[model samples]
Structures are given as structure tokens and as C-alpha cells.
Target: MDTDAILALLDGQYLLILGAVLLIIALVAIIKLRGSVHQLGQEHDQLTRRLDTLWHDLDAMHQDDTPSLSGKSKAPTTSATPDTSPELLLAERRLFEGLWPVAWALHDKVGGFLRAVESGDPHSESRLAARNAALEMRSQINRSRPFFDAEIEGILTQLVDIEIKAHLTACQYLDQRQSNLGVSSEGSDVRESYRNKWRQLYDREANELINHLVSAMRKRLVRHVP
Candidate 1:
């Protein structure tokens, strides 16, 4: 071939090679883009599931806290009737009457303390009062342990346990919050979420236990009526 034709042929081959390189680059870019899109979709789905679980938890808490039309929160009621003598029934009723006030007071004080801590306004006085109320309730329960049936004793123990757990969780969250004050970090955010989750869980559990205790007490007292 002549030099001019040979040079033209070489240039055409170079252009074909350059086009092929560009096509490969475009394919690689397209694959990477699809991979990124898929990863983002998976992340979005995980976030959505977390949010749904959080919403369900909050809704359950709200339902537990709300009172029914009769000005009392709905709770499961026991239907069993007492089969004891009149004197025993009277004694049981009297004991329960004496214990109910302290039980309710303990619930109120612990609940108040938890609310204050969760709202970022933890008060030493409220915590102290709650501790005192718990002590008093414990003293009463111990003193009256002989008179309580197994079911009532179990409910009382659960109530105390729930109170202690709720109180401890609140204290831990408060301590964590104080330690992380003015320090904004990803680790702190994760810790905060963890503490909040535990606090809410304990609070919900406390409310449920109190409801169950109230139901048991009512069932016992209702047998005394008529």
C-alpha cells in the first residue's frame, strides 16, 4: 500500500480501539450506579422497619396510659369468687383496704419520677419521695405477707420489681445524658437511643403491671361486696 493509505488505515484502527474502550468504561459506570441504587434501597427499607416498630411501641404506651369511659384504664379482671368464711372475707377486705392506698401512692410517686427524668427535668426531691414511697410499700407488704394469698403476693412482688426497674432505667438514662452533655457525637446518639428505648420499655411494663395489680385487688374486694 502507499504511505497515505497505510496511515489512514492505522488511524481508523486507533479510532475503533478508542470507541471500544469508551464502551467498556460506560458499562462499568452503569453497573456501579445500579449497585449504588440497590444499596440505598436496602438501607431505606431497614429505616422504614425501624420507624414502624417505634410507632407501634408508642401507640401501645398511649393506649395503656389512656383512661376508659368509666374514668379508669381498661385492665383484665379476674372472675373467680372467694369461697371463704365471712370472718376471713372481712379480714381480707380490711387488709386490702389498708394496703391499696400505699400501693397507689407508690405507683404515683415512681411514675412522677420517671416522667420528670424522661422530660429532662429530673428532680432530687421527686426521686427521694419515690424511694420513700417504695420503702413504705415494701414495709407494708412484708408486714402483711402472712395475710396475702399467693396470687396477691405475686402481684405485689411484680409491682415492686417493675417500680425498681423503671426507677433504675430512668436513673441510668439521666446519668448518661448528664455525662454526654455538650458533647455531640455519633456514639452519644446511639447511647441516647438505647437509653430511651430501655426507659420507654420499662415505663410500659410498669404501667401494665400496675393495671394487673389493680385488677387483682378489685377482684378480691368485689367478693366482699354483697
Candidate 2:
């Protein structure tokens, strides 16, 4: 071959090698981009799952249909609080579980007390029932004494106020009905005045009960984050 022919052949080979290098570089770049995209997808999916979990927890807390303490095999604690961290859940769970049983006992005691007032029997049955309820409340407060810090104490105080109001309202209504049954000619005016007073007292107590229950529940609310 002549020099010109050999030079042309060498030039064509060089061009082919350059083209091959460019193709390889392109493939490597494409592979690296794909890897990055896959990593981003994984990260996005994890974030989505976490967000969904947080939403579910909030919904559960709002729904108020969670299992009762008795039905719950484990502690009835949850990460349902709003804007809470993961570490907070464990800490809160410990605190909440410790307080729950005592709270429930107090609740039941208050309920029983209210029912006794409603039973409308002013005899020994009523007095005994009231005494037992009061004893139960005292017992619960003593048992939960250790866990009752400022926050928990405040909550319990609110709850007690609610119970007292509800009991007084029901009792007032019962008392009014009982007193209105027997009236004499001379005492008719006094009985009527008493009935009116009881009615007013009942209304006031009912309102206070509702307000206190709402306030107590609101104050106990916690925030959680997923």
C-alpha cells in the first residue's frame, strides 16, 4: 500500500475507536443514572409509608372506637398523639400504661356513684352505695399517687370535677321529684320554691359536667409524628 492509502486506513481506525469509547461512556452514564433513580424511588416509598402510618394513627385517636382497656391484651397505649417523635411514643406508652388502670378505676367509681344518685333510693342502699363509691375513689387516688405528677394530677382533677357535676345534677333531679310527691296546705309554697331551686341547680350542674368532661379530654391530648 502507498503512504496515502495507509494513512487513510489508520485515520478510519482511529475514528472507529473514538466512536466505541463514546458509546461505552454513554452506557456507563445511563447505568449510573438508573441506580440513582432507583435509590430515590426507595427513599420516596419509605417516606410515603411513614406518612400513611402517621395519618392512620391520627384517625384512630379521633375515632374513639379503640378497644377498651379490658379487651386490649397488651397495654392500651398508642403513638396517636400529634407531632410526637418516635422516642416520645415509648416514653409516653410507659407513662400512659401506668396511669390507665387507675384512671379507669376512678372512672368506674364515679359512674357507680352517679348511678347510686339515679337509683332514687334515699334509704340505706343509697347510703351504702355512696360510701363504697367514695371509698373506691380514695383507694384509686392512693394507688395512683406515685404516677400523679403535675400533668396527670391536673387531668384527674378535671375528671373529678366532671364527676361531681354529673352526680349533683342527677341527684338534684331525683331530689326534686322525691320532694314534690308530698305537700301540705301550709307547706305547698315552700315545696314549690324548693322544686324550682332544684331545677336550676340541675341545669347548672349538667352544663358544668359537660364542660369539664370536654376540657379534661382536651387537656390529656398528646401529639405524635411518624
Return the top candidate by TM-score.
Answer: 1
Off by over 4 Å in 1: 1-83, 180-182, 194-202, 224-226
| Model 1: per-residue Cα lDDT over 74-110, one tens digit each | 3333434557688887899899888889888888898
Name the 10 consecutive residues with the lowest summed lDDT in model 2: 70-79
TM accuracy, model 1:
0.57
Residue 76 in candidate 2, Cα distance off native in Å: 25
The CA lDDT of each predicted structure is 0.69, 0.49
- Pairing residues by index, what is the TM-score of model 2? 0.33
Give all TM-scores, in the order shown. 0.57, 0.33
Per-residue alpha-carbon lDDT of candidate 2 for residues 45-110, written as tens digits (9 for 90 to 100): 998997576445433332322223221122212223343456655654665565555555545554
Clashes of each: 0, 8
For all predictions, the C-alpha RMSD in Å is 12.8, 25.8
